[model samples]
Target chain A: MKKYTNTGSKDTRSGFGAGMTELGQKNENVVALCADLIGSLKFDEFKKNHPERFFQVGIAEANMIGIAAGLTIGGKIPFTGTFANFSTGRVYDQIRQSVAYSDKNVKICASHAGLTLGEDGATHQILEDIGLMKMLPGMTVINTCDYNQTKAATLALADHHGPAYLRFGRPVVPNFTPADEPFVIGKAIMLNEGTDVTIIATGHLVWEALLAAEALEAKGISAEVINIHTIKPLDDTAILKSVAKTGCVVTAEEHNFLGGLGESVARVLALNNPKPQEFVAVNDSFGESGTPEQLMEKYKLNNQAIVEAVERVIKRK
Target chain B: MSNTQQLQDFSTQVRRDILRMVHAVNSGHPGGSLGCTEFFTALYQQLLERKPGFNMDGIGEDLFFLSNGHISPVFYSVLARSGYFPVAELATFRKLNSRLQGHPTTHDGLPGVRMASGSLGQGMSVAIGAAQAKKLNGDKHLIYSLHGDGELQEGQNWEAIMYASAKKIDNLIATIDLNGQQIDGSTDDVLNLGNLKTKFEAFDWDVLEIKEGNNIDAIIKGMTEAKSRTGKGKPVCVLLHTVMGNGVDFMMHTHAWHGKAPNNEQLAVGLAQNAETLGDY
Candidate 1:
């Protein structure tokens, strides 16, 4: 079995902030807009360094999205920052009409996603943003796993010419990925290779998948772990090759079971390999106010849950 | 021909195109299109500082966005007649695989459209963003947008309105087609947008009223004055009071033709009222 180590603990939002600060200095055409959450989105350095490039849109999410779309007209790359819930749900029509349908070069960077948003509860934590964003035609949906991956993804999307949604979380987690690893859109990263079962994880659950691989290896069960950051253009080649070798798969995400990574993987398998698959995702339910650790444990979104799902899927295979 | 006569002739041809295109399809909004025919003609013909050919960036030239996009017939006609696309392509309006979408959209790579704006109350924000980009680039050009009076009911407009004034986006001229009618009924009966001029003034905007919006000379004068008000401290708003379905005696003065197409006989009546001067597509 292969082993992984956490370099440190860091929040993905800070990675975004670091990336934005770098972009402010590097790309003259890059601009940022915040809908009354500049501090929460960690945009202090960018705002201070490039005041002319920042727009404070004051609590209006719809206007922010529209303004971002419009800024793309004269060759300016606009990045909009807000909570995940407000970014996807509140201004869906604005995104649909002005950004997605029009094919504008706007990057919608959403933070505080899923139950890991902690005590702010379901109203603030958004679990359906991935599905909502991926449904738009030509939209690139990316959910990074750690601080290093998030920063790399932010820097990479500046050169990508199209509407994209980059989803991240608020809570700090294990910073395992390498600092200089170049983030590639729509490419899955293979963490460990084994022959028993394939564990495809994304977002916060990626760290848990690594832990599950170690635990499964202790029980004399070999596991293959893969991190799928981009959900829209799913890396079907990697998933099919892993599932073809393992004969079964377990998909994990910090989202609902329906219309998420699980469903996407299920479709790919059902269409190609037809392997036995299990889902480690939230059922049809909303999250409540709880600490980040409490919510992860209560929702069965930990390493133990992934191990159990892998075992169940291996049995089916 | 004089400048006003030339524009009036072009506007008459635009009205003919609107009536014929809607009548051919048997579905479209001709009421607001006819009402704003003169405004469209003047803006595209004489007002806008346009480049020779179509370009999407529009950095050095003026840009216009149609917020109330149901009135696409007039917009499409003027865009085609002004050489954005082939005038003969007006026959493909609302057809499958046509760049002329039911509303103005950039999805099909339409030459003139910058954003999709069938959904109301979004154009002002987009225009402001473009205006801000012009400011950032020191382009010294202006951004223009048109909306319906009824579109102000959407809350997003207020957000954009407040942002434009607060940001001092003076290089934008947002016009409202105050035709006093929507798909439902009169604006007064449905939801009265009380005292729009005063409302705009309270929001710290430079507001002007074009009482004879359907008149070619009046629109030209009003739009010229609106352009003069730019580059100061606030955005400019031109409240154009036009009769719904203007230029056609039968369709005028009512909301009945708001979204309804003209029948064959009705099309003949409308075409008779506005004789073609620049020829039809």
Candidate 2:
């Protein structure tokens, strides 16, 4: 197995802020809008650098979405920042009518996703945002794994035209990806190569899949790990090739199994190559207030859960 | 550059177009469309500072968004007659494979429409956004929008209303079609929008009213005054008090025609009341 090391620990939101700050200097038409969560979304530096391009839209997410859609009419690229729940559900119609149906180039950047939002509880922690965003036609959905990947995705989105949703988390995690890797929208990253089972993961679970692969290797079981950053316009080619070699698969994400990466992988396999697959995700349930570490452990979303899922799928194969 | 008689002739033709299009489809909102005929005619024909042809990014020109998009008949007629698209395409209103959807949208590459609106209370925010962009681009042209009085019940309008004033978006003119009727009943019975002039004033907007909203000259004068109030540090609001079905006598003083198309006999009456001056599509 190739060795991967964490260069540092950093929050994904900070990566977005760093990318925005860079974009403020690089792209003149890039504008940022926040709905009373500028500090939470870590957009202070961009606002400070480009006060003329920044808009503070108070607590109205709907108005922020409409404004973002409108800003696109005159060749301005608008980025809207808010929590994952408010970003997807609170302003769904506004996004649907003004952005998605109208074909506006607006980037909806959401932080504090899933149970990893910690003590803010179920209200702030949204596990269904990926499903909601992916359902909209022409909406590109991206969920980054770490700080490095998140920053790279943010920069890539500036050049990407059309409505898109970029989901990230609040808690700090391992920044394992290289600093200078060019982020591709729909390409999956190959983390490891093995013959036993294929492990497909997204968001924070990508790091966990790497750890699980190591644990499985120690048990004399070989595993292949893949990181899926973009859920919509999924990288089916990579998944099919890896699954064809391994003969079975386990999909992991910090979202409900019914609508997350697991279901998408299931459809791809069921149609072309049916394989025994297991899911390591939330079982259609809401999250509660707890530390992100405790929540990950209790929800069975850590490395141990992935290892178990891999073992179960390998047995079926 | 059109004189009063020319604008009146244009409005009569637009009203005729609205009645015929709705009658042919047997479904569409003609009540508010009839009421706002003069306003649409005045704005498109004589008021807006526009350039020939169409593009999505309408830089260096005025932009208009229809918030209460159910009244698409008047919007479509005015847009077509004003040369945004061919007037003959008005026959395709609300049919299968038509660019003119039931609600106004830019989805089908329709010219003259900047955003999708049928869902009410969203146009103000969009207009405010376009106004802000114009400011950012150093473009001096203004952004204009129209809404229904019933649309104010939607909470998002208040959010945009507060935002426009707080941001001092002075280059926008949002006019409300105060027809005093919705799907259910009169605005008084449905939900009393008490003292709209004061309500807008409290929101820190410069409010004006065109009491004779059905009159072409009155609409032009009032909207021109509203335009003069622009760039003075606050957004301007024009309250247009129009009868629900203004031109046709039988359809007036009630909400019956809000979304219902006139039958053959009623259509004949409506067509006769507003004689075609520029011919039909």
Candidate 3:
């Protein structure tokens, strides 16, 4: 539907690992805890360079979350890394009490998020993570689009003093954003200006939103694409302004539509500016073992679906 | 480090604080707190080399985590007497919007509490985590954890025990207050912990037994032995045998006072047994 330049791709997890290494060297108080996914989480650098700051907590996500909370009490900023599923679902209570409700400054670094975890199947691919995290009070939820943005977001959460869930994914995605873009938390990045409809996307869907915008541009429809990396603090002004001018909306994410970015955006728009919105996300269903492309096609989480959602919303408007 | 007399006096003072704090609110777990007073006092006064002012990170100081958070009275008493907070704050315990709640939580920004541990069976995991943090920070300071025998029913403690042994978390030396009484009744009646030493050994932990846990001198010796056994690749799990309601004649030997506060009449009787060495909060 859209023609875009191909860029070199990199796994977002590497962004986390590289960012953590840089942050560890810069701040002595920055500590890391990993629950048996050292290689997967790319925590090898932090562990090697700052051995004292890296905790290889073997298969203890619950304990790791708790210990991370404890480290925060001592004025230490702790980053906990694990798969998205175990990080959120496995230790929800621990995060809810020790981190979120208690308001500890811990970075819940989650890798292998969404269906892109690929072949690890339904169990490892956690689509409900954003929903679970967003429900908790005082929790700042972030879903970075690509490698560069995820890397920047990881470093940014360390400076912010509160409980934060930094969600990233496995598959190597397009590394199009500037290598050193400043990641402003809770602020949406406007990729393109348009007047017909607003395409609000997050995480892997940011690239899709860009693709849909190019297709819509060719079809005489000006689609505004917004990258909503930070889902919790929804950047009300930017979102409302874009929605007010566009008069319709379409949300895209690699997660379930129930409590993911779509619902968050809908809530913000409902309060500020009521507009017709269509969600382009995994329809209330769990993921299965498949290739990233297969999973995307099966879940209807591709650029074509996003463009269609935008067209439907535009027609309704 | 405190000598024998200092340990005794600190133990008495902690017991006094526990009684008064619980009596003030007419709500708290006094039985186990009373039972573990000497053990906790001995550990704080003689065992731990702490800084004068309390810091949350405890970078240089040894860390202690209470898994059984219901026994907040004993923990609050020891913390206050040990100069973790102003002794006067003991009266504010469980009061309206006080740092000292019914459970140990960092929510109030309390200096000593590192995590919220009202949910049982999570403290050991948290302790092991803190111990792991110490290792990660290259800080060789030891960590201490106390748990009630009956509270072991929460399977997470055993999971942590298994993990510590497997990971060789040798820097952590934990003590289990084997008072053998829960709110329901004896540990045997509630859920048989089924041979704790055997369990710890099976879990590959360096296990030790303290027959006279409530005795301050014995507590000092046992903890010394526990500390000596560390630095190897196995985490130390010391089984401390203590009475449910120790120190006070009437409260001892039963689970009735496990969570019940001492009424005014019983409060006087309990206070008579423990003199306020550092003055009442």
Q: Is the docking of candidate 3 incorrect, acceptable, medium or high quality?
A: acceptable
Tell me how far the alpha carbon of residue B204 in candidate 1 is from the true structure, in angstroms, after superposition: 0.7
Q: Once superposed on the true structure, which residue ranges of model 3 sit more than 4 Å away at CA?
A: A1-5, A21-31, A44-54, A70-77, A101-104, B1-10, B23-26, B135-140, B262-278
Q: What tens-digit string does per-residue lDDT give for candidate 1 at B37-142?
A: 9999989998999998888889899999889989999999999999989999999998889999888888888788898989888888888888888998999989
Please tell me what DockQ candidate 1 reaches. 0.85
Candidate 2 wrong stretches, greater than 4 Å:
none
Fnat, 2 decimals, each candidate: 0.73, 0.73, 0.36
Pull out the clashing pairs in model 1.
none
For candidate 2, lDDT tens digit of each residue in A1-317?
87899999999999999999999999999999999999999999999999999999999999999999989989999999999999998999999999999999999999999999999899988888888888899999999999999999999999999999999989999999999999999999999999999999999999999999999999999999999999988999999999999999999999988788899899999998999999999999999999999999999999999999988988898
**Mind giving the per-residue lDDT tens digits that candidate 3 earns over B1-281?**
66788788888888888888888898998899988989888877788877777667788878888878898988888887777888888889999999999998887788777667777777787777678767767788899988888878876676678778887889888789898888888888988889999989999999999999888888888899999999989999999999888888998989999989888998898888887776777
Question: Could you give candidate 3's per-residue lDDT for residues A1-317 as a string of tens digits?
Answer: 33344367899899999999899889888999898899999999899998877877778788788778766645678899999999999999888876786678899999999998999899998999999998998889999988888889988988898999999999988987787679999989988888999999999999988988988888999988899999997788889999889999999999999999999988988787799999999999999999998999889998999988988998898
RMSD of 3: 3.0
> Per-residue CA lDDT of candidate 1, range A54-115, in tens?
99999999999998888998999999999999999999999999999989999999999999
Question: What TM-score would each prediction reach against the true structure?
Answer: 0.99, 0.99, 0.90
Clashing pairs in 2: none
* Cα lDDT computed for each candidate against the true fold: 0.93, 0.94, 0.86
